[model samples]
Target chain A: MEKAQEIIFAGFGGQGILSMGQTLAYSAMIENKEVSWMPSYGPEMRGGTANCIVIVSKSKISSPIVSKFDSAIVLNQPSLDKFEHAVKPGGLIIYEESSIITPPKRTDIECIGIPAMKEAQKLDKKQVANMIILGAFLKKRPIVKIENILSALKKVLPERHHHLIPLNEQALEVGRKFVQ
Target chain B: MGDNESKNEPRLMKGNEALAEAAIRAGIHAYFGYPITPQSEILEYFTLEMPKRGGVVLQAESELAAINMVYGAAGAGARVMTSSSSPGISLMQEGISYIAAAELPCLIVNINRGGPGLGTIQPSQSDYWQAVKGGGHGDYHLIVLAPSSVQEMADFVFEAFRLAEKYQNPAFILADGALGQMMEKVVLPEEGSLPYTVHNWATSGMGKRKQRNIITSLHMEPEKMEEVNLHLQKKYKEIQKEVRFESILTEDADILLVAYGLGARICQKVVELGREKDIKIGLLRPITLYPFPKTEIAKLASRVQHTIVVEMNAGQMVEDVALAINGKCPVSSVGRMGGMISSPEEVLHYVETMILKHFVSA
Candidate 1:
């Protein structure tokens, strides 16, 4: 196990970027690993470029803000434009391809583009794009187990949205297959 | 969020939400606050959680009204609290001073943002002077506690409320926006005993009691006001005696780093980074700001050749650190003002190039 894995999830506000980071952080918490999740806050987060940093570590995390990322999950073109350079030399950049016309051209970092919006539409739930990215993120990083993510989704999702659990599980599986 | 869930398991919680949950577990009676960036979650969490626990949560029209409501509730002997960011906290200073002078116990949380004015929404420790040096126009000191982690965010509310009740003075949780906004694993305290029962000192409607209770700070006579001021000073001294701090890796280190709240969290990592490079640096984290950990800092100053004070403000707490050392050792400061946050790497850069270059070995 690595000492720490710092991930940045970035996209527009309504793309569930914050929740994706939250679910990942919660999954890390379920594994009893120390985690810190910090979302881009303030009024600008409503419709602007929203990003969150999630650090999962074995030891206590010192700072929640990281200038460099071990991995980046970008949902839009701007996110890719902004965070593509932020990924470490050998780090991974998992992006949603449907919204990102210009894929990352960086040769140093590993880039995996999952057609998340297309997959979410295939699942008949456009809102599950974030979950698709989550699955792809796990496939790329495997920092936490898939079961941990499932349990984490149950915890992060509200009771009113519990009915969507099976759909979300399917979305996760679809995303995992996309990455594979 | 419930008490009946898995008790031992760690829950990921935001710093602001944790404060609300802890207050509920602490049996707080009422919460009054206004909507403010970075800290609106505190008031929102209380709105949802407090009403479930048969507590009152109100969103006042402004910070002034909210703090006055806190003063009213505390005056009537209810365990009440109010939270706001920098600008909003500045508005509440007058009410806070009255609460202190009237000797009403209450909890106040300042999830500080960048300031001097409505500076920025980002995290900053510029409120250090306002928090410790008395923001309001009075000779008063708040029992200020600086929480670094989400768990501390929750845990310190209980302690803050306890201290406020024990001293009959308002206790301030001086948390920065980073601490207020960040999420971390927190082992919340169990639903246990409260620090003090509200009915103990609260001035409720007297039915059986023969005498009427009044809570007011207006001392028109100079003699009476002087007596009140003298008593407050005595309480401040007692609190100073009980000041809490954490001296990390300072036993044999040559250079000491003094910081609190978010600054301390960042410097802790700097110390780790420094140790990796064989630079022997220590960190002194002051948990209590008002009762500024002067004793330990003074001692560390005597032992160490240099002390570098780090904060998000433009050298506010640096004054206190320099005062504590009192020229025993060279005390310098590195700060990020105007709502801009300096990363750990940046601080380490300053330490390596500037701080280490200027402050030579004894």
Candidate 2:
């Protein structure tokens, strides 16, 4: 039986946290992996706390909600405080350095603070910070291939944004290279 | 199998979205639904897809109007559906009863949320009595299909349509908020299936037919109404015979876990946990909740020393389990109400104390 990797993506609503989880889930589907993505729904998702759980497994997933995560990608300080303790021992926590003032203090899990906002600014689009974070996640855990994620982008993004594919791909590459 | 043979590619879809897509691919002619959380995605997805497929999609004034619109479309011999959550489903009960009494073929989806009133928009099986026992004021049963997975959410739409038309009865897909909100890989159905065709029974302007079809629930004559009730009872009996259930790891089990939908999925994990500790535990999942799958439960009841019914409600379906067992074994229930999900460990602990520990002492 193959292993199941559960991930939590948490941040502000407009920070692309949900979309990051969605892209990962779609990529997992492209790779024929059993996957489930559950987002924080209701009023809290407007401009407040928002998060999504994405589980990729090789077998049927019993539940979509995760109490403990194999990895967490946090884009803000509150998300760091909220989910840092939920990461499994020896797991990975990736956060955006610009948004989080105090980084995760856990010694058991590997914590990587990426300057995602700065990196996205370098790409001429600060909104793609989530993509940078996603790229770092792929670097840390290469569960799904980068090629699959690119095709998934085409499927998820609307037709009008087709021209932005190159920039997104560049953002992913920057994150992957910077994480090393 | 025709659609399954061709362009059936796996797409990451939410349960509600898959249900809407399946409805279109299943040749649904009309969709009338009011937006309600957890199930609002179903309505939203339909608004785009249904019109593209040359079908009618209406956001009705309210849940009452939505179900009544379904009743009208079903009487016209068009495959139609309406989806809502618990509170909305409550408002739809009167129309649903009318459709069932009229013996019209239509599908109603309840993406159930916690409730007695405007309950929290969280997953719950509290509507078991409402879906299985006929919530509306009548003595008729709706064929209730409880889907656990996103795949089943899509697949069952076709099956619900088929069964509804076969029996000329209103069928329901009784899912929950978790199933509706969560996303999973789903194999989407290909387009182009034969749409519903009940030309003989439909009131289609009496075109080239010797007699006009009258679709109405009220039979003013007492004797005629009795005959109609008897006919419905007979169809329900046939449905009971066609019940679908799944029994897992029960060949040498000491305890049987009876659950349906999401509860069953959680119980499956408990089964693995129990076996790891060398305890004998199995799962009995009811796919067709209306039929209740009593025969299989009864057979297992004779074998297992203890049975525990797990649900997301305060012990509604447990009554059915106890009835099916008929004192062959002790049947009990443990569940979380009002949208609180009992963790698998909590459930396992409950089973250990309630079933295993009790059996050891006895």
Candidate 3:
């Protein structure tokens, strides 16, 4: 609560990058924590890398647009290129190993690779790959409880897609396997 | 965490959706808006919900049609609103002038995007001149409200309508794409909880009225136009008391920062970063962009060593701050053009390397 978690999520447009940030913000809001979720918008999003920033804090958040990040969840190589230096020294970077060819070059920060895309391919719903990555991130830093995330998943997932909730929860648990 | 009180519950919602929900709760009778990026959610939300709530939601063919619809609905004693982004709002300028001249009450929301023409759908404050100074035409002003947060985006819906009807003038909510697209937790008001008044001057069909109410902005005679202009000027002066601003850490500040809307949110971080470096910096945020808190700014100008105005555009509001300070303090501005926003570190760099070295003493 003393220090806010400023996080950036970057991936291709189909990688569910924006929704991952939104889900965390929704969970944070559920816990009465101050939350702000901002997405990288405009014409560049057309097949380009889509990204978002999510900040969760106890105190009121001042600026939602920030340069540095306490953590990053990057799903592709281009994202690694853009945000590898963005994470604060000694902070965390959870990257998808399957999509990225070159790993992060930074030695000061903690970089963990979760083969999230590969893991999601095993699941019935491949789109829950982000949730798997989220689960791995939570294993490293449990900012929000899994139960709260499940509740947030209900809100983030449309009603017709509600059937995927349990599978997504399983994917989250699967994500913890890569890190631990 | 299990507070369980509905009133205390905060909903995480996008700024654009929050604006739409607030309008429904604020008891608007109609919504006339075309679809545009970053602002399309407003029209979509209204279309799905407004009709169910016994209100009309019409996606007009164009922004011009939307604004004219707003004028017609407001004249018919209906609380109405229309929304658009920069280019779309530019199309409605003439109708806005007509509504202003007719002294009709309505809400016009512009989620400003970067533009001179068909610019990117990115956030910008370039429309400040169009919003506060006069986007329309001749001798008329709209009560302009610029909000920084998602909560304020919702809250200002009620506030803008209140001010519009109170003064019998059109009101504008000048927001940027960042504020429109971002999601934040908001404590929402109840549905139709806010009250609004229907005025006798509105032509609500004269069934039992002694006099027929006619709504028109046209005046052929020069003297008649002058008389109406005099009345409008007096109303503008009276509305000056409605000016709103927020001061953060200014009481003991050495360097003052002036910004509005989302720029103010960024300056808040500038204040925090400056304080970390033992810089006595404060931020003065203007909420009412049109009323232009000149008196409050002038008062703060006397004590601070120097003032810096920050905005998204190339120093639009800075000129107003300079005029407000009136040579009492040295005023300079930091601005980002197009859709690029000012980062806090870049501002701190400017402050430490440029501003502190010249203006404020260590």
Models sorted by DockQ, best on top: 1, 3, 2
Which candidate has the highest DockQ of all? 1
Scored against the true structure, residue B283 in model 2 reaches a CA lDDT of 93
Docking class of 1: medium
Model 1: number of clashes? Answer: 1
Candidate 2 or 1, higher lDDT: 2
Interface RMSD of 3: 3.4
Q: Estimate each model's TM-score.
A: 0.95, 0.93, 0.97
- Chain B TM-score of every predicted model: 0.97, 0.96, 0.97
The runs of at least 3 residues in candidate 2 whose Cα sits more than 4 Å from the true structure, single-residue gaps closed, are A178-180, B1-6, B352-355, B359-362
Clashing pairs in 3: none
lDDT of 2 by residue, B256-315 (tens): 999988888788878877898888999999999998899899999999889999999999
Candidate 2 C-alpha lDDT tens digits along A1-180: 977998999999889888899999999988888899988775675468889999999988876765678999999889999999999899999999999989899999999999999989988899889888999889989999999999888877777987988888888888897676
Residue-level lDDT tens digits of model 3 in A28-114: 888889999999885555468899999999999999999999999999999999999989999999999888999998999999999
Off by over 4 Å in 3: A44-46, B1-8
Report the Cα lDDT for residue A144, model 2.
Answer: 95
- Residue pairs with colliding backbones in model 2 are none
